[model samples]
Each structure stands twice: as structure tokens, then as C-alpha cells.
Target: EYVTPGGYELEKILNRGSVAYTHVNEVWPNVYIGDETAKDKYNLKKLGITHILNAAEGTWNNVDTGAGYYTGMDIVYYGVVAEDITTFDLSQYFFSAAQFIEATLSNPQSKTNKTFN
Candidate 1:
């Protein structure tokens, strides 16, 4: 979460965008089946999230739990990689950050996109 200039709480940042959900397996953990009520309350539709990148293998089924509820949503699963902390490279993550900036600049809703640079 971030604090705006006026101190209002903003959405949490993820890959340079405001993420509606984080650590999908933890917070709302189990995917609820046969329940449209939860989706309505969560406001997932209003958030305009069009993709889901599942970092778990067997958990793909869990995301399927929300399938029919949303239209035109894309979900892809890339299995997690176990790595030692001592050898991790932080720079690799920056590419995603750069891509996020590009996405925001190209977004139709962005004021920056409307202005002439």
C-alpha cells in the first residue's frame, strides 16, 4: 500500500500496477466454488484485472474455481522455482518493472499517454 499526498491509502503495488490480490494462495487461499457472492463482495470485476499468473503447479485447479464467473479472463500457470537466497539476483526483477511502466504509459486511461511528450 502507498500513501497519497493527502494521506489516503492506495492499492498495493505489484509489477508496477495496483494489484487487487496478493499471494493468492494465502489471503483468500482456497478458491470458493459455487459462490458468486464472494466475487461481488471482493470487487474483482471493478478492478479490471484481466490476467492471472499462477505460481503454483497443482494450484491451477484452484484458480479454475473462479473461471466461469469472469468473462474474457486469461490465466496461466508457471510453476515455482526453488532458489537459494545467497545467489539470488535482484536485477532480473527490474525487467518486469520496466514493462509495467510501459504498460501504464500506453494505457488509454493514463494522462501521460494523452499528453505530448
Candidate 2:
């Protein structure tokens, strides 16, 4: 079985660097990782994004744009109500998140799916 590194070890790696501000990065073709600011409709249009997977949903320090938020837009949204706490066990959402992303990516009509991880 795989074990998560101890909190001290994880903290050492996490706190090694200061927080850096950056624009959304395209880690894969049509896939992105960015802050909540990337949810703007105009920006998504400009970037040619067709789908968005929000790993962090809800109103707590996260983008509040659920599916209903993009009314009349051609974009598709997938969301997971995730917390930023270390003890939250983010792994629980991994499979579902991957399935959503895969579905979007595999859709022949979907040219670009931008996921905000």
C-alpha cells in the first residue's frame, strides 16, 4: 500500500517556496491550471476553451461559478466541492475529476477543455 508522506515532510516541500503569482498554464493540450480568476467568460472565449472542470467549487475562497453561472454560454462545467485543508483527502475526488475531464476531452465536438486544477 502507498502511504502519504508525513505532514512534516509534506510541509517541508510545500513551504520551501514562497507563493508565486502566475497566469493560467496549459499543462496539457487544452488543459490548464490556474487561480479562480480564470473563470471569466470573456477570457475563456479568448482562450478558445469549451469545457471547465473546477476542482474547488462553492463560495469558500473558490470560484462560485457552478454550471448555472455560465448561462447561455457554450461552455460545459464540472465541479467538485473540494477544501484546501491538508486533511481533506483530495484523493477522493481524483477518479471523478479524471472521468469528467476524460469525457470532455474525448468528445469529438469538444475542441478544447480547460480544467482549473
Candidate number with greatest lDDT: 2
So what's the TM-score on candidate 1? 0.29
Report the number of the highest-TM-score candidate. Answer: 2
User: Which residue pairs in candidate 1 collide?
Assistant: none
Native-to-model Cα distance after best TM-score fit, residue 65 in candidate 2, in Å: 1.6
**Candidate 1: tens digits of C-alpha lDDT, residues 20-109:** 543222122122112222234243334333333222113223332333444443321122222334474535545664454355436444
Candidate 2 structure quality by residue, lDDT tens digits, 1-117 = 345678897788569864355666665565767665446777777777777777767677356668897778888888778776778787888898788878877965563443343
Per-model CA lDDT versus the true structure: 0.31, 0.69
Q: Give the TM-scores of the predictions, in the order they appear.
A: 0.29, 0.71
Error of 2 at 81 (Å): 0.6
